[model samples]
Target: MSAAARETPRWLAPAPLWTARTVAAASEEFLRPWIAELRTDSFLADFLSIVGGTDGRSPADLPATLPERSDEDGSYRLFPSHSRRYYLVLASLVCHRPGIPDHTVQPALGERALFVLRRIRQGAEKGFVPSATDTGTWQPATAHALVPGERELPLHRAPVAAFAAPGTAAATLGMAAGQPSARTVRYGYIPVSGGDTVADDVTTTYVIRAVLVRDPCAPVISAPTQPFELAGPLDPDAPRRPSAATTKGPTS
Candidate 1:
């Protein structure tokens, strides 16, 4: 056996019969620092644009941009383009897994996935609601409260038809909820070389956390169950609020 493999505990070695799960104790440990360093509209715009491109959309069609300030309720209002929402959902889903070497899907990231998943679910539910104006543009809004029930969907059972080719085995991903009974499915993709020996294999997994219900009548603001934290090139004590003297619009 290879030295590295021998060094690993027998239980820690990858097994054909086991699916390992990764969990983030706090999602904000990564999110807050990233958000705090976004001190300008240009940064926000560019970030959202990159996020949108991941979903196959032109950034020009995104919604009206917002200032780089978190609202009084501590939520950052990012007006990503209509097409960008899908990317945001996917990005949010994966962000908590910072240093994973490749995109190997696991059952779920546990509590770390909760923060981003909650935000994505809220955005998706809002997208389904009727528009308040006839302008045909969807309103970019945020809810302060956790929408009543969790919006959980089984990862493998949820229809990813929009993202995958017809009849492909994309459904074999992972469970959708955080409960102990959750099950995981793995779908592997292999690339064949001239000799047909497997050149590469990639797998993606998903887990449904919960199915959230919309509560339009609920209060718009509430205390966070957990506060956001900072990581990577950002100082936690740095002023989160932008300088008052800074003017709006692009600054050279």
Candidate 2:
């Protein structure tokens, strides 16, 4: 195995479990139906607020705010106060696809990562969440370390908080607020390597974070099996293994 392959972390198994095409197809199908069921503006607002850790409200407390439709495009988009970052992340993760160009997924992944970081920071500011360490305090060190020159991107404002967990650092971005009180978020990175000598062949280590929110009755969102079928075949030797995808239904 190559050096990069050897360094592959155990947490990033989900990214490679199914190919990018599979992820994208599953996302479009599974998520479109789920979002359509919401059908209310406040439903999305509360969902975004809860996910973003703004007021530390649960999905149950969300008012009846629905997304406005674009007269020109006829697509549903979140309200302005809603974080475009979180929406994109949820969309990407729930809809990942295999064999698609990295250029497409990269932007969504980066945006999601930044969204989590911002949420953690916001939680810290509101005293809803604590930084990574157990000292029960926030520190600059808890922030994510950007790859040198990549800091200039508007989405790069927040730093990623690393922890020993199952998902990528990006997944845990906004989960800090619910830590100890409502949820525990874990963050890490997955490095994909192989193929070419140039940067083109270098698969990025996607930063992913998973939020374990407190919901005894939360509905489980099923991971579609179609993605696996679409992606050629899973590498038997791949380090981290992918499991069925499940979402902790509306937080309440």
Candidate 3:
């Protein structure tokens, strides 16, 4: 093996054999803490303020112009800092109904947006379900809370999906100041949104990958999960094949 390949840590084991149920469960596990936090009124209030309110007035240039904490770089910094746990808002997208051309919907970020977290907890025990949107092409109004137009919109809930993975700290990238010299890395997820149709294919399989660096000088170790698929309405004009959404590291 190459020197870098040899440096792969034992903890950086191969991804588990993923099934729809297993994916849902893992997604739920990652989100449970945030979900509990959302259940609290005070937490919801603070989170909404961070996300800006859910007024339903989304910016015309969404995904491109999504807001971020001034102190943060690419991902929006989330709260509960006192606990030393962090959730970062990595990417957000406005998905449209099937048959709608890509241009009509808000453009997607080159980075992977949140996927399947919204429905993981409440969806069927056997599989995944994407969140639903009411309009043909709608921009997400807020990252922190579900908006008014989406079907079955709930109050005090996150509009985007989230998952957990191992990642290097922002300081490593010089995005933050005032850090210990030693490198810091943590397992975290970038919040993304998925609804009716993230893509035009009848079924889309997302290949989730994780990369970790144990030390500043260590070679990065990478792994990929078993293919996880989500069903979507088929667009006759679109190719009849499974589409792939590969995960790169977080936006930053």
Candidate 4:
């Protein structure tokens, strides 16, 4: 084997096949330090204050915009932390998703708006489902992409009903901070709202993460259950130190 390859740490497996809870606990343990930092960091506290009360999606853009605590730099290669790329997993929480075209299928616009308003008022008191509006396009709003009176569906009266969810803290690329980042969103459906469309039923569409699925916010049905992570950048010329047992010199 090449010197570098020989030096690589021999990977080990957790006591054969581990249980699901074992996995979750392992992941929780691994990320404990980072999560603690987030809980106490003044920067995060201020950012949470900015994010908490607002009617934003759970772990939404607010999390995306939070400044990365790691020193961000562009020059390092083989280092994932250089730009502090991140992924997040969040569970169902009271949320407001911006409505879009699919929600505007009904012919009579007025009726559409009315139905959503009624739903909001009648929805469970625990969560506030906003009344859907005729215009919910924020991306296009600033660009003046749509003409007046030509109202497209906007997200207004949406509520997340899913119960307890797991949370995972992952890194994020500084995309919002003028750094390059990739974001992908995947829609999830419940038994009530999947498959071929039927008229008159509320089509529940939610992000798998209970928020936007982007580089900053990711969904995790299963997280690592063992002590594992990507290997740090390996140096080709570095010497490999012997293991603890081998390194101990003979007692004189």
lDDT of 2: 0.24
Q: Report how far residue 187 has shifted in candidate 2, in Å.
A: 14
Candidate lDDT scores, in order, read 0.22, 0.24, 0.25, 0.20
- Superposed on all Cα atoms, model 4 deviates from the true structure by an RMSD in Å of 24.4
Q: Residues 106-208, candidate 4, lDDT per residue (tens digit)?
A: 2232121110100111121111222367423212111111222222222122221111122211112111213222222111211111122224454322111
Model 3 clash pairs are: 113-192, 114-192
Tens digit of per-residue lDDT, candidate 2, span 24-109:
35443322211211322354454445434455554222222222333333333222212221122222222223322121113322
Candidate 1 lDDT (Cα, 0 to 1): 0.22
Tell me how many clashing residue pairs each candidate has. Answer: 15, 36, 2, 12
Candidate 3, overall lDDT? 0.25
TM-score of each: 0.21, 0.22, 0.21, 0.15
Worst 10 residues of 1 by lDDT: 8-17
Worst 10 residues of 3 by lDDT: 10-19
